[model samples]
Target chain A: MTETVSRCPVAHDQLPQPAPLPFVSEDPFHPPQRLGELRAEFPVSRLLYPGGEIGWLVTKYADVRALLADPVTFSSRNRQRANPIREMPEDFKEQPPKPGLFINEDPPDHGFYRKQLTGQFTVKRMKALEPRIEQIVADQLEYMAAKGPVADLVADFALPVPSLVICELLGVDYAERGSFQEWTATLLNLNSTAQQVRAAVDELDQFMLRLVKQKRAEPDDAMVSGLIEAQDGAERPLTDEEIAGIAFLLLIAGHETTANMLGLGTLTLLHHPEQLARLKADPSLVDTAVEELLRFNSIIRVGQLRVTTREVEIGGQLIPAGSSVVASNLAANRDPEKFDNPDELDITRGAVHHIAFGHGVHQCLGQQLARIEMRIGYRRLFERFPDLALAIPLADVKWRTDMAIYGLHELPVTW
Target chain B: MRVELERDRCCGAGMCVLYAPEVFDQDEEDGLVLLKIAEPPDSSLDAVRTAAGTCPNSVISIAG
Candidate 1:
């Protein structure tokens, strides 16, 4: 059993006015040299949501992982926007209730929605799409080469591959990926206006709703159509609204994560030419390199935030019920105790286990699909331009300076 | 060795299939490993090991 680390609960409780984010996790919030300082310094610091209200930020790997895993101890439902900064504007209430995918809901609701998605992300399903992923990567790279010498890899290739794949899976019009790309980016911006956030969610729901209607009329070889066929009962098949919720989850959760992984992952490989060479020599290294890349630079700053429903202990620290929490996936992957040389980029280091895809019940559903996409992307990109190198020094390349997604905003490269 | 699971300990994190799809499958409703192979082939031993190591919990084990 793990115990929660303690902080000034009274201080958090008394904080009527939540402070704005000084910087999002992706930025040089602190020095890259001191990436895990939040863990050692505040262990469990305070966070201000989009609203001015405060939430707890858990930094330790074990603590964050345990909190996210132990749903009985830590609750996620109705924990969306932390307690109001002052008073939530009535306008805030105008936004529709967030579609309760298993990501935010605790069981038995978590179990229910999760059940709906389980069959869809299985390895068999994902592996079937391997060739398509390879083809997608090859096509994108070909498109870039035809465009010639200097291309922004992030824009030209990395971003579109996952965007196209998710669209195809959910039965959305893949050709319209360019628009979906922008909307999704705005939604993930931590400091985006509330109206903007609400609009993004609403637009996604509408997009998904249209697909659901199309799938109902004529099924296809996609998850959306497969789901339309899955019947829970004779009369009580899932409603359109419910279908909207599930598609919304897969689309929103699946896309950027893979995009960020591919973009950031390519950057990592470029920075470490030795590792890239090792991987190119043996494509088998792609699997292990993926894990190393994930650990070296994690997915989310913290996977997801949870609130204690009852007094809970994690990693030996006890947290009071209703306290806010975040599981720091970045800190956990870098936890020296977990990896042999946690900081090293060794593609051959097969003894790796990372929480990049997360741990516990809410682990990423798109992980299998993501793995195939990344591996195929890496294989094709490296093979096509074995001389592929960053056009600019890493110091000059810009990463998203204020977002939860750690990614290169523009990965400029030339062969 | 046989791969076994403590179903109650499973939180539906699907690491098993990634490592050994031949040996593990997911429930239709939940993503928890459905134990497709009780006695995995010798060639799949490495995958089984990866599955056990990858499980967030120590829920997966190989016992003779």
Candidate 2:
């Protein structure tokens, strides 16, 4: 029942015995309860992939960090397209990752593409954009204020803030945000059929192709034009298709993750009134609050999936070569070993060590930008609407269970 | 404590800068690790150690 070449003779026998990956969480704010139980009794256990493959599940905080820290032992290739929670389309199996999809690439290829954009997302660079991000946040707050005594924060403020920021950063027209959001939502939906995913990918590709061509013809101050300008000096410049792929990734990644965070984060604050009161009492808590919020609500519910390239021991379990492994980011963040009162919301926890942005070479490229957005978004939000309250009861709030990224479908709120 | 850096291996994840901004910075042009202090004071050791441990590329090394 196991593929691991166990160092301990009884390790295979001790396996929680190949249960399916836990994707559903009973409580919207926390990871799946089964995952927490496994973290307690069996930090490293076997999981059944949707494709009928047995993989290792690493749930301990320390183990998850170690697993992600070493790229050599564990590869991100996903060559089998072995998703832990869902079966992938047959066409995706055994296919080389598309160019500019460096997230799946290892070594030199990943570095080559990552280096091109790293400068743009550096701590200082992202910090420089703080005032602009603050302006964007304030403008959204104003828009929401104009539209409400009642408003869906998801639609009015949370979604548009990151969407506008990312759109401006990429030089894409914000007017076309509706289509981009739809395409990306389709792409990110875990239940999206292969045909729907293909259609979304095709539409996004066509849109990016046109945008890249437009940037090439006329340079601008944004990232796309910057890429085109850099190409001239690059030894092996990326092709137009590669550029389009990169743009497509950034567009989807930039907006969706943060948009979900904003919507869900507001809801989280509303649920934890004491924490919210603490933040309002001391607005400076925004910095640590954002980090704590990130830790508490680890939005990437699917976890970071990797495949072992060689026989390796993680948390005393010997995982065999060529086996899929999932590092449960959500569980890791909530580990009692790493965090004090792991399940509670404490904004002052200063939870910077959480792997919400992940770790290692593929650690989120726009984390600094995301941080800046969240800091400003949450601070200005509470400051502006001092009497903000939820329009619906906490139990009635709809959680986004369909998408790979966990968040709220809509946060109905009023001042 | 003394620190050594292999800048080329830096993935520019900025974990180092985030942890030890006083001792590390990212180059403006490429975002590679730029060590500001080769031998930082003992007061900065914890932050530096955390930075080294969390660096995605494992490019930072510490020596006594």
Best by lDDT: 2
> In order, what DockQ does each candidate have?
0.48, 0.70
lDDT of 1 by residue, A1-415 (tens): 2223343333334433433323344343222433366555555656666555456666566676666667767776745535322233456644444564557777776766776776777777778898888888889999999985789998889888998898888888877776666777777776677678778777877777887898888888888887778764535467778878888888877778888888889988888888888888898889888878777777576356677888765554455777766666777676666666667878777745788887776777788888889888888888998899888876798877556577778888999
Q: Considering every candidate listed, which one attains the maximal DockQ?
A: 2
Which lDDT value does model 2 have at A344? 99
TM-score for chain A in each prediction: 0.87, 0.97
CAPRI verdict on model 2?
A: medium
Clash count of each predicted structure: 12, 0
> What value of lDDT does candidate 2 attain over all alpha carbons?
0.88
The lDDT of model 1 is 0.72
Query: Second chain only: TM-score per model?
Result: 0.90, 0.97
What DockQ results for candidate 2?
Answer: 0.70
CA RMSD of all predictions:
4.2, 2.1
Candidate 2 per-residue C-alpha lDDT over A1-415 given as tens digits, one digit per residue, 9 for 90 to 100 = 4455544544677666899988888888888899999999888888898778888888999999899888888898773378875688777776668778778887778788899899988988888898899899989999989999798999999899999999999999999998989998888888888789879988998999999999999889999999988899788999998888889888988999999999999989988999999999999999899999999999998899898989888887787899889998999999999999999999998887888999888899988889989999999999999889999888898898888899998998999
Error of 2 at B53 (Å): 4.4
